[model samples]
Target: MDDLIVKVVVRLAGVYENHGERVYLDAGHRALLGIARAVQDEAERRAGVGGNKVEGPVIKFPLDRAWREKKDRDDA
Candidate 1:
């Protein structure tokens, strides 16, 4: 499950770069969050866990912040 998440993230990052975009907007962040949540939820459900409980900090918060910072620095 973790591997799947990593793969998805890497693929998305590649797509973003290939598209000539230095930063992602809310839509991109939401897409990432949706993918992660879906994968995690499915894994939990398969394990007999009821309800989607994402353990750990929200991935988008840090990711979006870091990307924005990088974009700002690059623009400057």
Candidate 2:
């Protein structure tokens, strides 16, 4: 839909305006990133793809696994 495209463009423009040319590399732009995610979900829904559907292989990892592993190594 035209509106979805417009929303994407507007959100992208906001990212560029706030973070210069390479917006994707800016990890600290949480508000802009959230807006971009919402726009993506909206566009996906409009295209008949469920907004929550995963498009790729899922990788599961424990959040504190790396920290615990490092601590074990240090203790050893």
Candidate 3:
């Protein structure tokens, strides 16, 4: 992607996720997919060698559709 295009994508993604989504404005699925790809690329670049590899048991992102279905679900 072009440098300016990447910058625009990142900025738009940020605004949509942070503010636009909260206001009931729909961020189309295709844009979301693009954002994901862009972010992953940025991460891999910043992480350097083996950055894309996940070797730990840690969960970076939840796979469940409704991890918050129950409020106060966690134990203290």
**Which candidate should be chosen as best, given lDDT against the real structure?**
1
- Mark the regions of model 3 whose C-alpha exceeds 4 Å error after superposition: 1-27, 50-76
Candidate 2 deviant stretches above 4 angstroms: 24-76
Ranking by lDDT: 1, 2, 3
Which one wins on TM-score? 1
Collision pairs in model 1: none
- Which stretch of 10 consecutive residues in model 2 shows the poorest summed lDDT? 22-31
Candidate 3: residue 34 Cα off by (Å): 0.3
TM-score-better candidate, 2 vs 3: 2
List the candidates' TM-scores in order: 0.36, 0.34, 0.29
Of 1 and 2, which scores higher on lDDT? 1
Ranking by TM-score: 1, 2, 3
Model 3 lDDT tens row, 1-76 = 6997888667767877788775323545545766796678668877784445655544355456566555336632
List RMSD in Å for every model shown: 11.9, 9.7, 9.4
Q: What is the lDDT of candidate 2?
A: 0.70
What shift in Å separates residue 34 of candidate 2 from its native position after superposition? 14
